[model samples]
Target chain A: MANTQVDQNQVLPEYGPVTPADIRRAAWRHNLTLQWSWNYERMQALGFMWSILPILQRISRTKEELIANMQRHMNFYNTNPAVGSPIIFGAACALEEKGQGEVADSLKIALMGPFAGIGDTIQAILLRPIVAVLAASLAMEGSWAGPLIMFLFGLAWFALKFPQVTWGYKQGVNLVTTVAGGALDKVTEAATIMGLIVVGGFIPSIMARVTTPIKYVREVTVDGQLTEKVVELQPALDSILPYMIPIVIVGFAYWLLKARRQSPIKALLWLTVLAFACSYLGIL
Target chain B: MTYGIGIALLLGIIAYVAVVMNLGASCFWHEALIVGAVTGLIVGNVELGLMIGATLTLMSLGMWTYGGATIPDFMTGAILGTAFGALPGVGVEGGLAIAVPAALLMTQLDVLGRAITTLFIHGADKAVAEGNVRAVTWWHLLGQLPWGLTRFFPVFLAIWLGAEPVQNFINWMPEHIMKAMRVTGAVLPALGFALLLTMMPLKKYWPFALLGYILFAYLNVPMIGIALTAVAVGILYINLKEVRARG
Candidate 1:
C-alpha cells in the first residue's frame, strides 16, 4: 500500500534522543491502565497518554506544548494488548518528538487494525491457549510448578517491554514505514491459516461431546414369536462419526451467528435455552 | 481456613484489580487455576484448589475475550467454586458444577463493571479541562476499584455465608436437569469458537479448516499434536504463496 517505496539505503533522519528517565518511566507504565479505561469514544486514549507523559514532558517546552501533545494523543485508539507492539508506539513517540503529530496519529490508526488481526491470531488464538493447556496439564499431574510455570510466562511479557520500546525509538519511523512490506502480510496471513486450523481441531476435542438421550424398545418377530430389542441413537451417530452431535451443534451456532447476525450474548442465551429444552425432552 | 474472610476478599479483588492495573497478563490472572490457587491457599486446601482450577481451565480452553467482549466470569467462578470445593464431600467435579452456573451468572457483573468505568472516563474528561494531570491519572486508576469490588463482593459472600445452601441446591437438582446442565456446559464452549470464526477473515483458509476437522475427528489427535500439525500447514501455505507470487 506504500507508494513511495522508501528502501534500506534511504536512511530516514532520526529525531533527537528522548532522555533515559523519560524512556524508563514511559516503558514501565506502558502495559498499565491500557487494558482498562477503554471508553466508548476513545478506547485507550487515557492510558496511551498516561504511558507517553514522560516523553511529552521531555519534548514539549511549554504548558501549551504539553497540553496540545496530550490532547492530540487523547484521540481514539484500541488495539490487542499483547501483539500491538510497543515498538509501534515508540516509533509514534519519535514522530511526535520530530513534530509530526498528524503523521504519527495516522500511522497509529492505520496500524491498529492489522496489529489487532495479527496480534489476536498469535497471542489470543495460538500462544495463550497452548500455554494454558501445557501449564494446566502439568498442574493436573500434581505438579506445583504448573501455576509457577503459568506465572513465569506471564512475567515473560515484561521481558518484551524494554527491548521493543527502545527498538521502536531507535528505528524511529523507518521501521514502521516497512511495516507495510509483504513480509508482515505473510506473517499475518499465515497466522490466520494456523488460527483457523486450531479452531477446527478444537471443535471436537473441546466442544463436541454432546450425546442424545433418545432410545426405543422395538418389537420384532423372532422364531415365530415376539421379541423385544433396544435401539439407541447417540451411539449410532457416534459410530458414524465421533463428536457428530457436537459438530452439528457448532455448525448450527455458526449459522446462527453469521446468517442470523445475532450478537454473541443473544446467541449464547439462545443456545443455553435450546440445550436445556432439547435435553429435557430427551431429543439430544 | 483460618484466614477466611480477609484472605478471600483480598484474592478476589486481586484477580480483577491485577487486570486493570496491568500488573498481570489478562490471560494469566483470569485463568481458573491461578484464581483457585490463591483462594485455595486462603482456605488451606491448595490441592483441591489446584485440581478445581485445572478443571475450569480446560473448560475455558482457547476462549478469549478479544475486542473486549465479556465471556463467563471464570475468575469468580474459580474462587467461589474452589471455596465450596474445600468443604467436606465436595470433589473437583462438584466444584466445576458449581463453577459452571456461577461463571454464567457473573457475566452481568462483568458488563456492569465495564459500564461503571465510564464514570471515571468522564472524570478524566473533567480533569483534562482543568489541566490537572494528577486528577486525570488517579481517576483512570480509581476506575479499577469498582471492578475489584464487583469481584470481591460475590466471592466473599459465597465463602462467608457458608456453603450449605449452594451444596444443597446442587444436591436438590434433579438427575435429568443435571444431565441437561452438563449437556449445556459442553455446548457453551462452541459459542466462543463460533464468535471467533465469524471474526476471522477466512478468505482462502476454508480448506484448512476442513483439514483440521478431519485430522481431529478421524485421527483423534490431541490438541498439542494438532497445534504442531497446524504449524506445518501454516508454513506450507506461506511457501506455496511465495512460489506463486514469484512465478
Candidate 2:
C-alpha cells in the first residue's frame, strides 16, 4: 500500500547513486547471505527487501516508461521472493539513480499482493508438500531415511532459489520486459495447469466420501448364496454427516461473510451454533 | 523408557501446544517428530515412532497454506493415531485409520486458534502505540498460548485417557461402522479439493482443468509429468501467437 509520495521536507536517507555494477555486486552478496540462514527471519527480511524495488523504478520516468519499469521489476520480483528480493532492490536502486519515480512506485503497489501469494504457494504448497511426502513416505518404510530426506529437501530448496537470483542479475531489465510481454502469461498458464493437476490429485486424497447413513433394505440371493445387494436409504437429512456438513456450512458461511457482506465473526458464530443445533437434532 | 498411555497423551498435548503457540518453528514434520518420539519412547518403539511419523508426513505432503490459511493440522492426528494404532496388536495402517479422524477433529481447534490470533492483532497495535515492545511480545505470546495448549493438551488428554476405551469400542464396532469411517476418510479429501476449487478463477481456464482431470483420473498420467507437458504446450502456444502478431 505504500506509494511514491516522498515528502520533500523529510530528508531521504542517502545510499549513493545505484548502478548496474552496484546491483550485480549487492545481488551476489545477498545470495551468499541467504545461503547461510534459510530460516523465518531470512524469509521475513526478504519480503521487506523486495518491497523497495518498484520505488526506485518509478523515479524520473514518463508515465509510459514508469509502467514499463514497473512491469519489468515485478516480473523479476515475482520469480521468487526470498532470492529475488535483493536482486529487485538492487535493480530498483539502479532505477532510482536514473531518476525514475512514477514507474517504480506504481509497480511496487501493484506487485506486492501477487508476489506474496506466489511465494507462499511455491514454498508452502508445492515445495514443502513434495518434500514432506517424499520424506514421510520413506520414513514410514522403516528405512533410516529421515536425515537423507531432510538433506535432499534442503538441497531442492536452495536449488530453486539460486537460479532466480542469477537470472535476475544476468538479464536485469530485459527479464522484466520479457516477462511482462509474454513470459508471465506462459507462467500463469503453467501455474494453472499445475494447480489443476494438484486439485485432481486432491480429489482422491482429500474428498473421497467416508460414510453414508444408508442401510441395505434387502439382500439378493445368487445361486442359493446371499449376495450383499441391498437398497440403501439416505440417512434422514443429517446425522452430522462429517465431511458433507462441514463443506455446506463453510460454503454458506463464507458466502455470507465474503459475498453478502455479513460480519465474518458473526457469520462464523451463527454457523457454529447452527451446526451444533443440527447435530443435536440429528440433522446436519 | 517404556511409556504408558498417560505419558504418550501428555507428549501429544505438549507438541500440539508448542505448535499452536508458535513458540518455535513447528511444521508438520517437527510436530510429528516431537510427538512420535515421545509416544515411541513411552511405548518402547522410538524406531517405529519415527517411521510412522515420516509416513504420515508424506501422506500429508500436498497439504499447505495459501495466503494465511493452511490445510488441516495433521500433526496431532498423526501422533495420537499412530500411538493408538501401534498398540500391542495394532499396526501402521490401523494407526493411520484412527489418526485421520483425529486430524479432522483438530481442524476446529486450528480455526479457533486463528480467530484468537485476530484478537491479538489489535493488542499488538496497542502495544506498538505504547512503545512497549515487551508488552507487545508478551501479548502476542499470550495470545498463542491457548492456541498451542488446545492443539496439544486437550487432544493429548483425550487420546491418552480414552485410548483403551476407544480401542475397545473399535473392537466392538459393527463392520458397517468401520466401513463408514473408511468411506469418510476417502471422501474428506474431495471436500478439501472442492473448497480449493471453488476459490479458483477457472471460468476462462475450464479446458485446462478438464484436461488435467482427464489426464490424471482417466489416462493415469503422473501429475508432475502432465504439468510439464502443459507448460511446454503453453510456451509453444504463446510463441506462436507472438509470431502471428508480429507478422
Candidate 3:
C-alpha cells in the first residue's frame, strides 16, 4: 500500500479548504447511486465521479479546474462501495483541495484493487452471509426478528459512512501507509476465521437437513409365525453420522467448483437434474 | 384489479430501492431474505415470504456481484415468487420452481442494466467535454433509470399480469414433478454451502469448521451458540498472535 513515489514529508500548498458540509453532502450521496451506473467499460466511474462532485466543486476555484478534475475522476474507477469507496473519496477530496490532482488520480488507480479486496472480504464474504443467514434462520422459524435483525444491521453500514469519510479526509495518502502496516490483513484474517466457522456450522444444520426418503421392508415366517422387519436408510446413515449424505453432497459440489472449475450456473443446472433423477428413483 | 396493481407497484418500488440505493455496505437489501420479507409483507404473507426467502438466501450464499460481475437476481425473484406463491393453491414449492429459473434468467437483465448505464457514462463523457458540470451530474443521476427499470418492470408485470396463468401452470404440474422440485430445493442449498466453502480459506481453517460440524452434529449446539464460541476463539487467536509478535 505504501508508494515510494509519494514523499511523506512533502508539505501541501493550502488552497480552497474542503468543508465539513461538503463531506456530509458527499457522504449522503454515497448511499444513493455509487454503483447504479456500473458499466463494463469504466465500471463505477460515473457513480464515483457523481458522489464526490460536491467536494470537488467546493475545492476548485475556476469552472475549468472543476471540469478537468471531474474528467480525471471519470476514468476507470471501481471498488467496494462501502469500505473502499469512502476512503478513496476522502483521499481524493484531500488531494484535490491541495491542487495535487495528478497524484490523486494515480493513487486512486493504485489503491482501488487492494481496498476492493478488503472491502469484499468484509462486506460480501463475512458480514452479508453471517447476518443474512442468521436472519434467514430466524425468518425460517417464523420470527419477526428476521427483518428486524436485517434492518438493524443495515444501520451499522449507514453509521459507518461519516467516520470513514472523516478518517480518509484527515489521513489523506497517509491512509495508505496505515493500510500497508498490515492492520487490514489482520481484520480480514479474523473475519475469514469467523466466517469459516459460522458457514461450517451452516453446512450441517441448514444444508445437510436434506434427508433421504429411502426405506426397506421385509416380511418373513419364523417358527410358523409371521414377522415383519423394517430398515430405514436415512436414520441408519444419521445414526452412523448425522447429515452424512448432505455433507458428502456439499463436498462433491466443492470438488466440482474448486477442482473442476465448473461455473456456478453449470453446477446449479446439473444439481437440479440430479435432484430430480434421485427423487424419481426414491433415493432422496 | 386495484389490489393486484397496488401490490405490484409497491414491489416495483422496493425493487428500485434494492438495486439503486445500495447504501455503502449494500445494506443486504438486495439479499433474498430482505426482499422476500418485504414481498411477504406486501402480499399479506410475511411468514411464507421469509421461508421462501431464506431458502433462496441459502441458495445464493456465495453468489455476490464483486468487481462488476453479475449474478442471478434472486431479489426480484423472491418478490415475484412470494407474491405468486401467496395465491390460493400456489404454495412455496410452486414459487421456488418459478423463482429459481427466473432468477438465473434475470442475470441477462442485470447485464443489460449495466450496459444501459454505459450510455449514461457516455452522456457524462460528452458533458465533460462541453464543460457542463451540472450535465455530467445529471447523466450520472439518469443512469439510475435503467437499473430501476430493469428490476421494476419484471416485478410489476409479473404481479400486474396477475397469477392465474402462473397458478394454472403450478396446478398443472404432475405430482411426481412437484415432488422432484421439492427435492431439488432441498439439495440445491448444498451447492450454496459448497460455494461458500470454496470461497473461504477452508484449508487453513478446516479445524474450526470441523469444530463447528461436530458441535452441530453431535452436541446439537445451536447456531448462535457456535457463533459466540467462534467469536471468543477469534479474539483469543488474535491476542495470542499479538503476544507472539511482541516477543
Candidate 4:
C-alpha cells in the first residue's frame, strides 16, 4: 500500500498539453535550484539534458512525446549538478522535436559562457542591487513596504526566469543561434558594458591606496615655510630609490613563481618574511 | 509572539536552508532576498529586510568563488546583519555597517566548510570508482551538508540570541564609529575587485584594462559606450594591421 502511494505521488499531474506554460513551469523550478553561484556545475547538468534529447525524440512521435520529453526534462535535476544542465535540457528538448546532434551540442557549449556571464551580471549586479535599494529606500521612509519588496522581487525573478526557460524549450537550441545574430549579442554587449562601467567607476574609489613605509622629511622654517627633504639612509642610491624595492620584489617573485614554478603561497610567505625583515631594519 | 521574534525565527530558518542547500555561495541575490524577507516578515517590516539585503548584496556584488577559494561569506553577514538592521530603530545602513565585520569573521567558517566538503568529494570519487552510483549520490549529497550547516547554524544562532543585543550595540555606537563602518563597507567592494584583478592574467589584456580605467575615470564614459568603442577599435586595429602586413 505504501509502495503504491509512493508510486502514485511520483506521477506529476498532466497539464492538459505540454504547452509553453508547462516548459516555463519546468524551467522556473529548475532555475530556482540552478543557483547562480555554482553556474559551471549547473551548465554541465544542462549539457547532460541536451545530450539525452535524441533518445527521447526517437522513443515518441506525437503529443505524447511532448509529455515524455517534459518528464525526461524534469528527471535531469535529479541526475547532474554540473554547469551546462539547462543548456543541455533545452538542447535535448529541441532535438526531441528535430534531431540536430552535433550542431546543438556545439551551440550549447559555445553559448554557455556568454549566457552564464549575462545571467550572472544582470541578476547579481543590476536587478538585485536595484531591488535592494528600492526596498531600503521604502523602509527608510518608515512605510510598511519591506515585505512587499521581497514578494515583488521574488515574483520578478521568477517572471524573468520562467519565460527564458519556456522560450528555450519552445524554440529549441536554434533559439540561441537565431537570436545570437543580433538580439542576443546586443543584450550581452549591453550587460558587458554595464559590468565594465560599474567596475570602472570603482577604480579610483577603490585602488589608489597602495601604501609604503617611507616618508618625506620636512623642516619647519622660521618664515613659516616647510622644506621637504628625503631621509634616505643611503644617499648614493637615491636616484634608483622609489622604484627599487618594488621592482626587485616584483621581478624576483615573478621569476620564482613563473619560471621556477614555486607555489604562490610559498612565494607569498617568503616575500612577507623578507618584507617584514626589511621593514624592521628600516631598509625597505 | 511578536512579529519581530517570528520574523527572526523565519530568517534563521532561511539562513539554515540556504546554507544547507549551499546556495549561499552561489546566488547572493537569492540568499539575500530570502533572508531579508524572513527577517522582514518577523519584524513586521519586510521593506527593511529588502533594504538591508539589497545594501549587503551591493557590498558583496564582486564577491565570488574562484577555483573554490570563497572569500567573505556574505550569506551569513547579510542575513544576520539584515536581521539586526530590520529591528525597529536599527536602520539598514547601520545594519550594513555591523554586517561587514560579521562577514569577515564568517570567512573562516566558510573555509572550514569547503575543507570538509572536499573530503566528501574524495569519498564520492571512491564510490564512483567502485561502480556504486547510490553510494556516489549519497556521498555527494552528504558532502553538501557541512557547507550547508556551516552557512545556516551560525547566522541562525547569532541572530536568535543576539538580535536585541546587536540593536542595543548599534544604538550605543558613536557617530564616528558608524561613519567608519560605512566607509569600510564601501571600501571592501574595491578590495574584492582588487582581489579579482590580481587573479586575472592582465598582461595580454592590459590595454583593455587601461582603456576600461580611462574610459570610466577620465572620460567619464558609461560602460556601454566604452565596450562598444573598445570592440570597434579592437576589430579595426586588427583588420588595419592585417592589411598593412599583406601590403
Model 1 DockQ (Cα-based): 0.30
> What's the DockQ for every one of the candidates?
0.30, 0.16, 0.30, 0.14
lDDT, candidate 3, A1-284, per-residue tens: 12235443332232247777777787777655677677644667777788888767765555556667677777666667787678877877776665556556645654565466578778778888898889889999998898779878987876786688778777774634455546645645665566556656666765554788888888888899989888788888988999898888888778888999996556766777788899899888
Give RMSD to native, each candidate: 11.1, 11.1, 12.9, 12.8
Q: Where is the poorest 10-residue window by lDDT in model 4 chain A? A: A35-44
**In terms of docking quality, how is candidate 2 classified?**
incorrect
Q: How displaced is residue A199 in candidate 1, in Å?
A: 26
Each model's lDDT comes to: 0.67, 0.47, 0.72, 0.47
Of the pair 3 and 4, which is ahead by DockQ? 3
Q: For this target, which candidate reaches the highest TM-score against the unseen true structure?
A: 3
- Write candidate 1's Cα lDDT for A4-28 as tens digits: 3435343222213576776777766
lDDT of 2: 0.47
Top lDDT: which candidate number? 3
| Real A-B contacts recovered, model 2 | 0.20
TM-score of every prediction relative to native: 0.60, 0.44, 0.61, 0.46
Once fitted onto the true fold, the runs of candidate 1 whose alpha carbons sit more than 4 angstroms away are: A1-17, A173-284, B1-4, B21-27, B163-247
Tens-digit lDDT track of model 2 for B1-247: 1235667566766665546423222232344543565566666676767766776666666555432333556677756765676667777777777777777656655544544444453444344444343554465345545456657664556565656654565458565433332322222222223333444555665566566556654566654455455556555656786799899
Which ten-residue region of model 2 chain B has the weakest summed lDDT? B183-192
